[model samples]
Target: MTRTPASRRDDYPVFRRLQTRWMDNDQYGHMNNAVHYALFDTAVNGWLIEEGLLAETGAEAYFLVAETGCHYHSELAFPGWVDAGLRIAHLGTTSAVYHIGLFAEGSGTAAADGRFVHVHVVRGTHRPMPIPEAARQVLARLFPAA
Candidate 1:
């Protein structure tokens, strides 16, 4: 069973431009599936870290991955640059859903789309933590009221 991707360049709430490394491509001549998740993680975490929301000291204040999945729409190979888009689709008391779109540079639509859910938890205690107001502010921008 195949699912169509719902990602487009325009659907991305935030853009993170990335350069495809030569090593990203597998012998099959396309970027491996695992690489796409790496890109998605990079884009999302980079945004959070840059925004000072997910820091080493405060990382536990943020939850780790609870669920993740990606849908491939087209082949993207090495030497090609991509603009990774990020957005929040759902926000919960202790979890959040992020939608990531991978677009080939200059393309209007997405090459791949992914959804990741993370449940915030305490560092050592491993208990669910409430989503901070500061983090909510960022997520709100990506998930405005409909």
Candidate 2:
């Protein structure tokens, strides 16, 4: 497979600042690879909540991750922060792809970057459903034209 380069923070329109805990680091002296995926999940879900598209209570529809991937460019260690940048790569009726860049605080290049594809599903049935208009409106802001 062809290698993709790491993204810059500015390439994404939204960002969430996340701190690295001491426990996040591994015996190797750097943040664990699994932690990167956790950060990506947290960033996306946090943005959804911030946009009022997700609720702890009864939400119109819930999203389930269908796919996810990451490419690490550098190391992240404890005792610092990460600014996770988010953007929409593709938007579909019931599914959407989110691009995430994990940049060390104040760094211009990404330490790691990834993609997540979420499918909107019914609350009870857990079956795929069309994305709500309100959610769509919020997600559209991640697009460049918006």
For all predicted structures, in order, the TM-scores are 0.91, 0.93
For residue 50, model 1's alpha carbon misses the true position, in angstroms, by: 1.5
Worst ten-residue run, lDDT, model 1?
A: 54-63
lDDT, each prediction: 0.84, 0.91
Each model's backbone clash number: 1, 0
Pairs of colliding residues, candidate 1: 63-120
> Which regions of candidate 1 fall more than 4 Å away from where they truly are?
58-60, 144-146
Q: Which candidate is the best by TM-score?
A: 2
Per-residue lDDT over 1-146 for candidate 2, one digit per residue giving the tens place of the 0 to 100 score: 88788898679888999999999999999999999999999999998888887756687678999999999999999999999999999999999999999999889999999999999988888899999888898899998544
